[model samples]
Target: MGSTILPTGMVFASEQNITENSSYSSSDNVGVSIQKDENGDLMVVKTETKARANVARWGAWQYTHIALSTGVTAGAINTAYSKGIGSVLGIFGLPGWAIGNLLTAAGWTNYGNSPGNAVARLWDKNHNGWVGFYKRTGYDGAGRAVATAYKTE
Candidate 1:
């Protein structure tokens, strides 16, 4: 068996079993399983899956930044978590300029510094800051399959 990590962040791998003439190869989102069918003919199974996620990290000092930023309180974050970032912003009734300032001060790397981007991210469905979307489709040797996972974490 051998594997390679490509520059595009895709993974490529292959393995072979000489005795049974079976083989396998896969990349970031696709795979092929090659084996002999009952009739001793070569059969290939193709599988594909797609997924996406993102995260950003901040130092403990970020808390200091938020604390020092004007008009933003600890409760602000709590409110966003319990409700949504849009709700929190709505409660403030601040102008767009003020909202931009607030987010810039509190923003993390992956979260945007602008009001619209920040709200969409912080709300992130559950407000835990973890969001994911994925889809899987193709043959898995035994049967064809199609699935989608819109969110997790």
Candidate 2:
């Protein structure tokens, strides 16, 4: 496949042997699409925002790096929020724990919504040096979060 940047700034990947009658569909939430132009060229359109675009396009490498650095299995890390740990603060005793748990319950109404965030948190805590590299490579905390989300998704 090949990629082209549309005038509207959407990045599209293309396949060969497409005809004018070819159909199109988005491959993922990041907006990858396969389309046929008037000239009958088949294309995969990627209209993901900057962060999601990277993850959708280059997730394999990024996720592997996160896994190596965090020393925690991706499956385990992805389920951290659901295992009742991220849901509780528990520092100020019972009342604090109650408030923390309440917020956690509210936040997790839809569990496992974003596994990347959990992995990102672990990376942020355990891999400070790599986090710096990620920043230099244009990944802020939110970008890293999206990267993690992309991995899980």
All candidates: CA RMSD (Å) = 21.1, 17.0
Q: Model 1, which residues run further than 4 Å from truth? A: 1-18, 50-153
- TM for every model, in the order presented, reads 0.21, 0.18
Error of 2 at 104 (Å): 41
Residues 17-76 of candidate 1 have per-residue lDDT tens digits of: 423555444353244334333444332333333312111211111111111112243345
What C-alpha lDDT values do all the predictions have?
A: 0.32, 0.31
**Looking at candidate 2, what is the lDDT of residue 109?**
28
Q: How does candidate 2 score on lDDT?
A: 0.31
Best by TM-score: 1
Residue 101 alpha-carbon offset, candidate 2, angstroms = 43
- CA error at residue 76 for candidate 1, angstroms: 66
User: Candidate 2: which stretches are off by over 4 Å?
Assistant: 1-22, 27-29, 50-153
Candidate 1 residue-pair clash tally: 0
